[model samples]
Target: MPKLTFNIFPKEAHHGDESVWSNLIGGPSSFSLESRIFHSISICLMGISCFYIPYNLYAGLYVASFSAFIFGIFFFHQYYNSRFNARKHNNTVFGLIGLLIFGVNYFANSGIHGSTDLIWPAYLLLVFAITPYRQHLKWLTGYLVFFIIVHGLEFYYPELVKYPFLEGEGQFVDRISTFPIPLVVVYITIKFIRQSYDREKKAAEERAIAVEISKQQILIQKQQLEDSNSEKNKLMSIMSHDLRTPLINIQSYLELLNASEVDDEERPVLERALLTSTNNAVEMLSSLLHWSKSQLEGPSVHLAEINLLRSLQVTLDMETAHAAKKEIIVSYQIPADIIVKADLDMLQLVVRNLIANAVKFTPKGGLIHVIGEVLAQECKITVTDNGSGIPVDKQDKIFSIKAEPAIG
Candidate 1:
């Protein structure tokens, strides 16, 4: 025996919304307007057909046509009102009204004595095609109940079924040969309309999220600019106060030296004082130049492969005069063959600043040591001094703008 497979519900149970069904049922406001216009035109056409069907002078046909015109006007108003109000609420009422009109018109024109009975089923089919998903079960149940009552009555009272009133029975049987076809078409249409609405909703949500992200990025950039401006203002204040004091003192000392009424012994002592002042002025000038160059255009370097040992030797030689004046001994422990690619001028500035700082802060007979080593893909250089070390509290601020020498 083949294995039994049980499906508790059809695959359609898992199926969701569809656009085609929504469009038929007037899901969107635009589609509802279109459907309303279509319905109005169909009713008008039917009224014209009634006017010419059997004889043009029939009062019943004229009355039916007039009824269609009134209903058409009603449909137009419902379309606009539903659109103006919310679509969901109006569409529900619109579908209900359409069903009511179809049923009433069928009974009015093809009452017990009419000749066009086949028209009722066709009108019933139109309702099934366009009714909203929510109204499906109601439409089907009502149709089944009506069909049973009409056929039962016809069987009981055969005289009540007149010539045109029962004229289209054969056509009704032929049309309904494919019993479940309309139901399938309606289901597919509903599923399609729902999917379309879901896709549009998702795309709108994504666009909103992207806009929010862009706004946050702009805010972050604005904050960074404000911080930079604050830093620049603080640096300018320090430059103005610190640089002006030293220059003023040098000028005062020079003016005093210009007077020519001094003894030889006093002159020697004054000359020594002048020399010390000149040295202090030079130190201040050097600091200003270094700081200005670093600020104005950053450090310029010519990158090339250079021997680390040779570079250190050259740096020590350049600082020999300054080191001797301070009684500082500079030494290096670097491998001779260790080479690295770097800008010579930049490395020299780094080495000079470290060594000079050491000499400035060191006491007499203090020693300075330079060390270098090659590591994977990079090189490390360190300058150590046996002098007064920087205080722990000031270490974090050493590379900050607060530690920069005054400029102007």
Candidate 2:
């Protein structure tokens, strides 16, 4: 005996609950429209089949038509309820009712003539096969029960087999015995196709997600590398600029010391050079520390309205000794009321660098003038020198990373 499995049953247990099946069935009125149209056609066909049954030759047609009409009316009412109220209960009940109507009709119609009724079982098998797998088990059980009852009736009342359609039917029982086989084959084929489609969709979604994640990671790494490179460039610029002046002063002082006699009058001049070198080195270190702090920690601006003339006076006073030793005359022309919003430390560094550069490049007796003016929205501080001014061609490249002519 072939063991019955859930797969073999006519109507499958609703395995996935109502939520799952609702998604599969889609929204309300979608399947209902189709069901309504099918039932309406079947009702029309049943009415036509009744007319044909008047002729004995088409007697079995009436029975088929009557069965179709009964099932159609039940299905039509179910579809009507489902469409109006959006309910699954009606659909489930209608399906069960369809199975019962078809089963009973098949047995009654087949009793009169076994050969003509063989096709009824084949029709039932097709309907069960085409239905969704979740509903197949229940229908299959109904089919089995109907089959056993019909077969028993045929055996007990052999006189019911005298219809003309059975005379030339040729072994009706044997020919239709394996009707369930074709249904099983079709069900398996559909199930396989659906499973394969779902697997491919899932794989594609996973691949898309993986690709997106990779793109985000690459973007993050690129940003980190750019930030690191920027910091390195800033550090190198600070080191090169801050170290140049002190090293030059030290070299000049050492050369003078080595060339001159101990009793020479230029000994005091050499001592002044040493003092200037030490001061320049200290200023450079301080400037570098300030720049580094600004870059690393964050903006630390302490704004104040400072008198431009007073600030210039203070800077010139600080650099006066070095300027006198170099024969560079420091002068200033500014309005007393000129004020600007600035952070004192940062403005001092800016002015100091400009003054130091002027003294370094200016020849003996060259004049270094600090000028200040107030515009409508901004204050202008200018450091001008009579020594060799920056060449026109090198001015643009002064801020470049390569060596360039100095500004006086």
Candidate 3:
């Protein structure tokens, strides 16, 4: 079956209240504040003049009617320039037009007693609203001087001022008709100014928020750098002290080998001691080199599947001499088929360090165990010793660099 649909409004009209309002305000972001203000005020003045031009003619003031007609033409054309011609409102002829027309309209349409007096301040406000701030004082002073001179000229030369309105009744009628122009002028100007102020305030707040976020990120980066530097200092202190111990052991063994009274059986023991010292030095140096690399390039992991027993065998063999020195029974059991995925360098480093620590702290003839277990989701390799272990309270600090208590 075919269905029919109907839309009441045109697709363009469906753009909603904001879109319509934006067009009224010269498409929001497209127009400058001055341009939009000029356009808005022009529309308002054109409307006011439409009513006054007819009203003035009907009231028998031909001079005021002609003045309104002139103003209507000016507002319409200037509105055209602001909306379509100029990118921003820079017209100053409005002020000159006001001065010229109002000057003639003043004398012809009952001088100081006419509606021109009511419209003067409103026109000045419109001029100030569109013009630059630096020109405000100049315009204000010029308008003030013009007002005083024109009023003074009429006051001294009474014959120059004409009376179009007859008496109090005519004056009252004139005031009523002329009042709305200034009222609408003040309203439009103040409204646009307030809206502009609120927008500037919101933009300022967003800039402040962005600056604050950037500062916080910079602070975080600074703290990380400080922590890294602190760790580097701690590592150097530990390495400088630890690295000397194995070197001293090797030096003493070499000195004994050079002695004349060295026995045949003692040679084997000395060689074993030398091997232990060499292994310790190699492992420690490897750890130091890895630490230096991490500081320079940051950390990286390369994961791959590897046989657990095959990986640990070389490391275990290196530790055999150290174990023999204390007569510590070091044993490990892992199924040959126990495969795990890991970064091989990082894995070997961790295991070598654990076994070294075990051999360091364990008492004479202590049993140190290295065991590997495949759990439901993961693999666990543990190196443990049957020596006085860390106290429960101190145990948690083992992996923490800041408050790491001594092992022995």
Top-lDDT candidate index: 3
**What lDDT tens digits, residue by residue, belong to model 1 across residues 1-408?**
122232335355346443332332343435443343333334333444443433312433444455556555665555334333433234455445545554444444444334224444544445554566667778767766765666566568655443322347633432352233334433444444465568789989998999999889889888866666655555454345434534555565566567676767677776775676566556645654565455444334557998877765645654544565567787878888899898654566567667867776788888998889877888898889888878787788877755754211
lDDT agreement of model 3 with the native? 0.78
Q: Model 1: runs farther than 4 Å from truth?
A: 1-101, 105-196, 219-302, 305-340, 369-382, 390-408
lDDT of 3 by residue, 27-112 (tens): 45666677678888988888888988998889888878898899899888887666665445445687788888888888887787
- Give the 10-residue window scoring lowest on summed lDDT in candidate 2: 1-10
- Give a tens-digit lDDT track for model 2, residues 1-408: 121121212233355454443333333335432333333333333343343334323444455456546544554454344433444334345445555654555454445443334444444544453355677777677667766776686689665533323444433532353243334434444453455468779989999999999999899989877766666676566556546655665666777788846557778877886886677567657766776667555446778988876755545665654577677788877899988889776687678768877887889888898888877898888999877767787788766545543444
Better of 2 and 3 by lDDT: 3
**Overall lDDT per candidate, in order of appearance:** 0.55, 0.58, 0.78
**Candidate scoring better on TM-score of 2 and 3:** 3
Maximum-TM-score candidate: 3
Give the TM-scores of the predictions, in the order they appear.
0.41, 0.44, 0.67
The TM-score-based order of candidates, best leading, equals: 3, 2, 1
Clashes of each: 15, 13, 0
